[model samples]
Target: MIDDSRTRVLARPFPPRRCQALFALVAIAFLAAPAAAAVHPGQAELVREVARDTGKDPAALDALLDRAQKQQSILDAIGRPAEAKPWSAYRPIFLTEQRIDDGIDFYRAHRALLEQVGRRYGVEPAYIVAILGVETSYGRVTGRYKVLDALVTLAFYYPPRAAFFREQLKTLLELPADHLAGPLDTLTGSYAGAQGWGQFMPSSIRDFGVDADGDGRIDLQGSLPDILSSVANYFARHGWQAGGPVAARAQPDAAARPIEAKDARPQWPLEQLEAWGYAPLQPFNPGEPAGLQTLAGANGPEYWFTFGNFYVITRYNRSPLYAMAVHQLAQAIEAGAGPADPAP
Candidate 1:
């Protein structure tokens, strides 16, 4: 799955505007800014709004404001341009022998939990492992950026999607103490505020988040149970179908021409797409719904009939590249290392 386990869960937030990750820590800068200037355009107002929404005393918001302001620089530093290179370059950075080795090791270590989560969530362990592989290399590389700083920077300073980040900040503030697990421990992830092995943002951490360990709290960092469970919960919530095929190889029709995927929501239907020569090796149940997804390959082109489950994977990350990477990575993990338990 593309994991919104990075993008999908985080999607509930408002769309991004156009803020880029700056190298410096904006959190420190926000606090150090001259006492006179308003560091964020609507920060104070936002705090008040949060207070009104959550019924928390406005005074309690001071800490939140301080935290948000202090972390602005961190968000600015997230999503480094250096890290945004083309997939040809980015793919090699992650699809390494070490990653493959680590994927094997991760699968071996969490065999039981992976299987259990898979069974309960109706998602395949391979897909989950692939997500971990692509997102953080089996948790070996879950970003060093402090989540608070990243979220706040994107929320307040990043104009393109400040509203979305603001919502994440609000979610972070409203997280129950049970899920908080103390502030310092939860402060790390991708530049966009995704956290844990699955790189879930705060709101996702709250809504689709699951307490895998059954400790009565979901702690993405410390507990594998919680992390795996949270991932499974994310897929389930996004409409993952147990035992359903995620993708299928297809040959396009003579008239089938490459078309760009829509920028907004996906509403295209499979039956209509058949006119374009998108036929699969195995006939899917006609009753099932599907979509058209064409991809560029190393040589020429690749096409697949994406189903609802495949679309659910995209919720983790919007890019078809991201979804494909996860799908391929999961396949690799399955080939390189066997599952921890007998297939259910």
Candidate 2:
């Protein structure tokens, strides 16, 4: 999940004639600028590729690119994602009492739908709620950036992941016209171009979004059923084993090797980890794959035996901290605590 503070712009409605005059001036300014002055280097190639893929006219695609502005803030935010923070820092941000309470309310409000979807998709209700809670705070903060602007800015201006964002941009462009809420350019989402309660990227939405209410449309922004079911569906598709363990607390052996780089995926058998001087507080299948993760806690270090389900959670976001936050938050909400209550 990409997190950033929202920005609000207030504008008084303009008279029709004044609006027309303002638009005319802006159009003139754009026309007078040299093409290179507005278009990012390689943007033309992106436009051509999108046009070829989507059967859109290249000039029209170029014009759309011309309208997209480079957002330095997006670049800045992407540079230091929450995953980069230490576990002690990142956990508190998402595991706050307020978020946990909000998650409970969200779950209670949509209990039936969540249960139905969870049963159908073989995912737990708490996990579904936790994913939404972490991603957008139960839709309270779905972001404020126009998705077109964010995608274009990253697709052209951010070289590190330009190819990936460009593909996302292409996916956005190819969305079925009827699947969207409004004009493509006006759609708003996170700086990373993740949309709706689940904060799904364009490709994810296309692959997993469902019309759960059967209203002949999939509206993630306004439809709780669609949003909840879509999240469950994503987990199911990503190989979330039904009724499986997610994680367990572990005591490190005196000779336990210190964890360096933590891999979210379960890569070693429980037997192997046991041999390495780490043991789970709860028994798990000895043959099952597992990974050891060490987190920097306020006191010192915290270790966890992450299971396959934990890896599935990481597929949503590749951070062990993120999965832990979601797991812990889900547990807290399941305990029926309010924001004022301490986590379980």
Candidate 3:
């Protein structure tokens, strides 16, 4: 949701001294307030709804809310997600040689399990590894904020997406009480409440998570099998066509018209796009649905004729830049893994 208003916040330059002073004040304000008195405005309604939905005790839910502290930092982070960056700046962050190397290492380390799940789910191991690398650097940086605090803060205080986060909070509450070994308030995740190696939101975990290792429990944080299988299952459920092209270089004809939607869903057929002056370098099925995307790069604008697989990737993340990064990173990892790596 980084629109013009959020862009202004990101672009605004603040002096170090002023930033330090402002942070200090905010910190002091947060620290001075007791947790018992830190209830969000919509806490009661949230408690009632969650209690009704999950059949949990209202007092218990209320106590969780009372103990949850509001984090302004989460709000600040949400306002400036990585997807907000232009493709020029966004490409380098995920397309580094180091990330690709790490992805290769990750793929090799879990090659057997990944291959097993890939075969079952019809997903490539490199793509799964690339998602892990891009999401949390293969769990090296899976966030540190308490999941409860992040979700509650965003659910009540953040107006733009409050309803969405509220739904996620409900899903988190509705999870089996013993899903996690520890207390709910102790679970840690991204500022937006995405958790574990795959950075899945609560709803996604509930929907797509699987116990791949057959341990009778789904532990995304500690179980590599579950993480890999969950990612593959998510892709398969989202209609990831096996062996389909994700994207291809395209030369836009001079008379090409700009696409109407900025989002990456496949709205145009290949034949229609070709008629509209976007021609792919490789021959493609004319009946297949596709879209033309122009990415701003350091050199210039690069165009691509994206296919349905590309659209499916976008379901995991709405940004076309993110989808492309994952696609390219997967390709790089496959290339780096050499001929020894198993093919999809």
Candidate number achieving the greatest lDDT relative to the actual structure: 3
- Winner by TM-score: 3
Q: Tens-digit lDDT track for model 2 on 198-277?
A: 99899998999898888887788888888889999999999998889898888987999766545788888888888888
Model 3 clashing-pair count: 0
Q: How far off is residue 135 in model 1, in Å?
A: 1.3
Over 4 Å off, model 2:
1-38, 337-344
Against the reference, the lDDT scores of all candidates come to 0.73, 0.85, 0.87
Please report the TM-score between candidate 1 and the true structure: 0.78
Candidate 3 on 1-344: residue-level lDDT in tens? 54698789889989999999999999999999876633788878877887887789988888887877789999999999998888999999999989999998887777788888889999988899989999999999999999999999999899999999999987888788535525688789899988889999988988899887787877888899889999999999999887888998888878988875677778878899889888878888998888888888888989988888888889989999999999999999988876454567
Taking all chains together, the TM-score of candidate 2 against the true structure is 0.85
Instruction: Sum up the clashes in candidate 1.
Output: 18
Tally clashes: model 2. Answer: 0
List the candidates ranked by lDDT, beginning with the highest. 3, 2, 1
lDDT computed for candidate 2:
0.85
Which pairs clash in the backbone of model 3?
none
* RMSD values, in order shown: 16.3, 12.4, 13.1
